[model samples]
Target: MAEKVVMAMSGGVDSSVGAYLLKKQGYDVIGVTMQIWQDEKRCDIEDKGGCCGLSAVEDARKVCADLDIPFYVFNFKQIFKDKVINYFIDEYYLGRTPNPCIACNKHVKWEALLARALFMEAQYIATGHYAKITELKNGRYALQMDFNNPKDQTYALYGLTQFQLKHTLMPLSGIEKDEVRSIAKEIGLKVFNKPDSQEICFISDNNYGGFIEEEGGKKILPGNFVNTDGDIIGKHKGIVHYTVGQRKGLGIAFGKPMFVKEINPLTNEVVLSENKELFSEGLMASDINYMAVESVKEPMEAYAKIRYSHKPVLSEITAQGENILCKFKESQRAVTPGQAAVFYDKDGNILCGGVIERAV
Candidate 1:
């Protein structure tokens, strides 16, 4: 009998093609769409953004029907709200910029969705994530860079646990985005030409501050924008409205362009500084997850990415108790706290990753 595999279909070209590929591979493939949130305003259907909305569900259903696979819609709204959304808000409230995609992968897609797949007796769970899983000699799984587009490779998948990695598969790992689109078109999937959803799915307009206000019921107050010398240059709408390295939409005019340096929530202050001040030499990361090996014993040289779109920089990493400190060979800019710092080996294998704690 063929092994049963559950594919997490998100109604995107990558996922639609993922299902098609898995089905063709002779796996007992079943398509599962996670209903993570509801469209309260009903405006997102027209917006063509936000994933996990009603339209995404409809699209996933259509693809499953076309693939002749059993479709299942798992309502993970409560889990998503508690794990991903709440964590995002809490991190921002604490003067840190959280990557919701990393949290969603760690908490929702891998933990919650994988558990649902296991409950359905699936031997493996698959997704459209642009990551590769490789089995090592010691019966462990390691995440490798996707063969498609190195720039689009998802190193954030380093957070995936050994068990999750062992049972998970990424069909889009070997194929480029254009090839995935072509396959989806060949399969006549409805979302073949659909644009990728870039923003947080729960946030309709990408107004994170507005979402926080609506959910938390706390009105963020106006704050003073100060320079490095502690001189108040102007007033900001709120501290939450600003982030490190933000230059546009400051609503403040200075002699020269100024960027947001830091947000002091306790004092309700947004610090502005020159673009050069944003660069940092190193950062500390906590809550590290190691999939390739047990732990980093000696200081190892590797490439590290401070953000999702950031190019991996040469760095030397050391494990300090529960935290890992990464010192880059050169200064990096906007190394935000709560964002993940994923490490990779010389050959592009993901070493490990963790959340940025502080920049030194």
Candidate 2:
């Protein structure tokens, strides 16, 4: 009997073509679209942005039909809200920046969806992420970055559990975006030309402040913008409205340009300074997960990325209990808290990753 695999299709060319590729590899692929969000005001899922909604269901179904595979819609609204949306809001409220996509990947997609896939007797769950999952000789799974592929997604996937990695397959690893789209076009998938989702799916307007307010009745509040010297500069709309490294939309101008260097939720102050002040020697990260190795008992040298689009930098990582301290060889700019800090080896293998706690 052929091994069954569940392909998480997002109504985009990447996932659509990914399903076809897996099926051609002789596996029994079943396509699934996860319905993660729905709001009366933000209902433009059919338009070229974000995943989820009924349109995603329809588009994914059509692709499955073309591939001769079964397709299903998995409702993840509650879990998404609980894990991703709530975490995002709470992080901002705490004056820390959070990556909701990482939360969604860890909770909704892999943890919850993978459980359902296992229930369906599928041996593996796959996505269109441009990262490779390989098993090392030490009997562990590790994620590798494709240096040649510009669309590398290994950063967002570093938080995945070992079990999730072992049961996961990413066929799009090292494949360029253009090549994937070309395959979709050749296969005649209708979503071949669909634009990639840019904004957060639930926030159609890209106004995170508005979304936080609408979903509020939570602790989002207005505060004072201050300088690093603890002197008041201006009034901020709210802590959620501003992030570290933000220069525009401050509504107040200094003699020269000023950037937000820190957000202190306790004092309800947004610390502003010159752009040069954003540079940091190192950062401390909590909630760490290791992939390339079993554990990090001693300090190690590796390349680390603070954000998805950030280039990996040479750094030294030392594990301290539940957290890891990453000291960079060179000064890094805007090392914001609550974002992910993913470490990679020389060959681009994910060594470990965690949520950045502070810039030290």
**Tens digit per residue, CA lDDT, model 2, 171-227:** 898789999999999988988998898778877878888788778567567789889
Pairs in clash, predicted candidate 2: none
Candidate 1 — which residues are off by over 4 angstroms?
40-46, 147-151
- Residue 50, candidate 2: alpha-carbon lDDT: 58
RMSD to true structure for each model, in Å: 1.6, 1.1
Best by lDDT: 2
CA lDDT, every model vs. true structure: 0.83, 0.89
Compared with the true structure, the alpha-carbon lDDT of candidate 1 equals 0.83
Give me the candidate number with maximum TM-score: 2
